[model samples]
Structures are given as C-alpha cells and as structure tokens.
Target chain A: MKQEEKVDFRLNREYCKACGICTALCPKKAISADDEGKPSMINEEACIMCRLCELRCPDFAIRIGRMQ
Target chain B: MEQHVFDRLMRDDKLPHMWCRGCGNGIVLQSIIRAIDRTGIDQDKAVIVSGVGCSSRANNYTDFCGLHTTHGRPIAFATGVKMANPELQVIVVTGDGDSTSIGGNHFIQAARRNIDLTVVVFNNSNYGMTGGQYSPTTPVGAFTRTSVYGNIEPAFDVCRLAEGSGATYVARSTTYHVQSLIKYIASGITHKGFSVIDAMCDCPTLFGRINGLGDGAKMIAAWPEKTVSIEKAGTLSADELEEKVIIGEFVNSSRRSEYTEKYARIIEEAQRERADLK
Candidate 1:
C-alpha cells in the first residue's frame, strides 16, 4: 500500500463513552470494539477513508485523517 | 492541524458533554459548528442561544458567544439581543418541547416577524429532559411516559408549521444525513430573514429504550428507510408515501423584509420628522 493512501484513525479514550457507534457505522468494518465496548482500529489498511465513523460518532471520539 | 479548527471553537475544559451515551445532541451541535464554518461568519459576531432541554446544554460546549436562557424563552431573549444590536448573527438551538410547547408562541411570532435568526429545533420526538414525556412533535401512537397507552395526539410537521407562520427559510434533516444536515444548516445561517432548520435527532437513552428502537446505530440506520427526499416524494403516490417522513427543504425565499432592518428604518424616519418639527 502507498504511504499517502493510509488514513490516520485514533479513538480518544478520555472522550469516549464506549457507545460502540464507530464500530457499528463503519461500512468496511475496519474498526472493532473490545469486550468493554471501547473501539480501536483493527484494519487500517482496509479503511476506504469514507469518514462515516468519524462524522457520525456521537461522542466525537473517533478522529480520522490522512497520513502525510 | 485540522483538529485545531474544532478545538479553537470549543471549550475543551467542558469535554465529554453530559448527554447520555449515543445521544444525537452531540451530532447536531457538531453539524451546527461545521455549518458556521461553512458560512464564513465571524465567530465573535455570532451568538448561540438555547432553551431548557437536553439539547439546550449545547451552548456550554462552544467558545463563541452563547446564552443558555430559561425554558421556552431563548427566542424571546435572542429577539431582544438582535433588536438591540442587529449586527450580531443569532442562532437558536432548542429542543422539540422547548420550542413547541412552552415556547410555541415565540417560535411562531419570530417567524411572523421575519427576524434575522436561525432557529434549530432538535426534534427527538419526546421530552428527553423530563423523562420521555410525549412532546408536541411526538408521532401519534408512539409510547411515552405521559402517554402510557400510546400518544393519540398528531405530531407537528415542523417545516410546514414554520412555512405557515411566514418563515422565509425552512428545512428538515435527520442526524444520519450528516452532509445534508450541514448544508441545510449552513444555508439557514446565511439566510437573511427568519430560518428554521428542524433537526430530527434521537434520544436513544429515554425515547429509544421506551419504544424498542434498539440502540444508537440501529436507530440511525433506520432513517434512510423511514424518510424520503422531497423530490422523490413528488414522484410517489400518497398511499406509497404514508408513514414516511419527508426530508429536505420546504421553503427558501427572501421576499420579506427583515425585522431589525425595518425597525432601523422606522427609527431613522422618526428622528428626521423630529428635526423637521423643531
């Protein structure tokens, strides 16, 4: 994969409420939730950069950006 | 970084808003902020006014000028502020109950006057702040705490009501349609006269739990199935459109004169008459 095609995805732990919205909304299923319901990027390479998770995140916990 | 754009506009000290998990108020607030950015409006000149409700807590999170007014009175206070200084761009962020129940009269009156204010009503269908009581916008046959046997009252079509009351601009959008929601809100912000953007939100904790609508994601996923764009609705028959919520702009006209500018003209004429009489 090209370096420029990579997307920066990170969940802010301090801001997250473990609502599981990011994992649920990702069309590509690139994000996954743990047993505690906290979300993390499980497939960074599969991300299409659609930004659905970031835009629809109720808590604004998920931040997605393009890597330079 | 792009993160600073949002950070500079927000009071990070108030991080992690007090709303329940998966509440749509946060999404609505974010859309409003993004719309303000889209309009290129001066942050210092804009004011966010809100009435009492779960959605009314939005002003506390922003760094711009804000007024967390009493229940059902945000529009009245915003009117007073606009009348005093017409230069300020006023935006009202209110809930369904806050705008339709106690503030119903003010809401209609503001539209009638064609004031230069953008009113955003976060319609969660029920009164989330007061324990899922059936609000004026709550759909009939829906279960609410006040309507244990299901709500018999018909819901208010917010856009139609605003258009009927003479709002120059009116639109309706759901939280799931983030891009459209942002565009509608941005257009509302730029509109000169009274604009009402009815934001259909989800109170997942109270309303959804009581109605068996599943969780946050499930409720949002159902939006596309429940609503149809106005253009598409025109092609569908009445029977086919039954029980479907129509989304998109209903009215956008700038024919009427704005309240503040007209008032200023009246004042100037009165002062000129006094000078001639002297």
Candidate 2:
C-alpha cells in the first residue's frame, strides 16, 4: 500500500455500453458523467486505483489507472 | 459485419476457416481480444493455452504467446504456466467436448484448487470440429450426428458446475450478448482465483443442421433475450425462461485463498517449524 503505487485501466470504448455502474462504484468518486450521460474521469488525482469501477462496469468500458 | 471489430479480431489473412459462416466462435474470439486489450495485460506476458478442438485454434490467431496442447488438457497446461510464472496472465480456451466431456476431471480439480487462470469454454453443445459429437453440455434430447435420436443424458450447467465445484469466479455468456461476454471476460481476468466463462456460441455446421436452426444467425438469435442475474435466475423455472440460454456471472468471491496464496502460507509455516527446531 505505497502512496506512489500505480494501477492501470485500459478502456475499450467499442465495448462500453455507457452503463454508470462504474461511476456509481468508484470509491474515490473519480468517475463523472458527460453531456451524453457517458462516464468520464473528472478527477484522476483523487483515484486510489481500487479498480472497483473497472470490475463493476457491465460494459467493460472504464479501466482505472494510476499510470498512463 | 465486414467493417467492425470482428474484422480486426479475425485473421482475414487466414479467412475461410473450416467453421461454417456465422459460427459464434468468431464473435467469442473477438470478445476475448477485446477483454485482453481492455485489461492492458502485456501481450508478451499473456499466454493463450488451448486444447484439440475448433475453439482451440484461437491460440493461433492471437499475437501473444500461445500453446496448442493435447485433447482436454488446456487446463493442465494453463495451470503449469500460471504456477511457473504467476506474473504471466494465462487463459485456457477449450470446446465443450474438450473441456467438459474429456477434461471433466481436470475441470473440477482446477475449480476446487482455485488455480489463478481464466478458462473460456466454447459451449456450442455439439462438437463441430469433430463431426458433430454430443458434448457434456448438450441439452438432453438434443440431436447430434452421433445421437440421430436425441441424447438421453441431461447437459451440465457449466456455471452451476463451477459454483458447485468451488470456483472463485464463475460466469456464463453467449456470443449474442457481445457486451456481456466482454464484461464477464474482463472480470474473470481481474479476479484472483480460478475463473470460468462458459461462452455459449453458435455452431451452424453441426448443431444448426441437426437442431433445424437452418443457419448460424437463427441459431445465435435463439439465445435468450435477457440473461437472469445469478441471484434471480435460481427462482425461475428453466422451461419458463425466455432466451433459454442465460448469461451472467454466478460467483465472484475473494474469500477463499488462491493456490498461490495457499502455497505461500504452507511455505511460511514450514520455515517457522524449521526455525523452531533451531
């Protein structure tokens, strides 16, 4: 549990169905919505990289990441 | 169809595979790639292990490390690969006959031991690659080349089998539900223990001709409209279900320690016992 630990999320947009499951499950509240109600990252700095968002997203849309 | 991810996931260079047109294996392959790309697992670090069957040929199309092993033995090979290098992300792709019929014993052991490997079974019910043999998952009374008069045996419910055998992560998805397949595949990859995705794909060459599905499209369309959530699915009667083929994750729990964790604990205890002797 180092402060500098990094996690990676590789989002494949083609697979994403725009389900908000990830947005609702993100522990850090890092996921936000766009004009079309699609989930987007509003605050990457606050992310703890727990991956709950990635795991919960029914579409496999969002990938949580600490490193690009 | 000609201008989608399917094209990219497929080996157009190797087009005209033995499989008939509209075979669900193609879509399942695409979903597998999407999940791999989505996880960002280094392709070099990823290994695709497969057995002898139509679906097993998938290892050839993927650019990552691949293993085409003996019949019904992909799990054995996959287990070795994962244990040898726990860092390597290992995946096993097998057909219904290769996985459930012949490799049934290994399947149960892997689930009970909870090896850290992802197992994707191409459950088309009939063994297309091997002349339409009825497999372990073929519905009872389903006709096949061998079973001209419907099979007398009941098919195994793969998700339920895994759940019963102690798999840490178990799910069932079909080619018709592309998004759900990808989602389940991704979750299976991230899960720390043995994960099985029983992918129900179309096999027009065999299952179609025998079941009178006519072709692959109608066969794939035969998949249920809505897959029940694992929690709610248990309550409904199998006959009452629409889209008779259900698709969803049945289990995802990290409570039971994976093989690696258990081995580590054993080693630690051994070291403590040795030290006490000193």
lDDT of each: 0.90, 0.77
Give model 1's TM-score versus the native structure: 0.97
Cα lDDT tens digits for candidate 2, B115-201: 899999988888888789888888888899888899998888888888899899998887766678888998999899999999988
Query: Distance (Å) between predicted and true CA of B74, model 1?
Result: 0.7
Listed for every candidate in order, the interface RMSD values in angstroms are 1.1, 11.4
All models, RMSD in angstroms? 1.2, 11.4
User: In model 2, which regions exceed 4 Å deviation?
Assistant: A1-68, B1-16, B225-235, B238-243, B268-278
**Could you give candidate 1's per-residue lDDT for residues B12-63 as a string of tens digits?**
8898889888888888898898899889889999999999999999999998
Global local distance difference test of model 1: 0.90
Per-prediction TM-score to the true structure, in the order listed: 0.97, 0.74
Summarize candidate 2's per-residue lDDT along A1-68 as a digit string, tens digits: 34455455556565554434456446687777567556777776777766556543433345555552
Colliding residue pairs in candidate 1? none
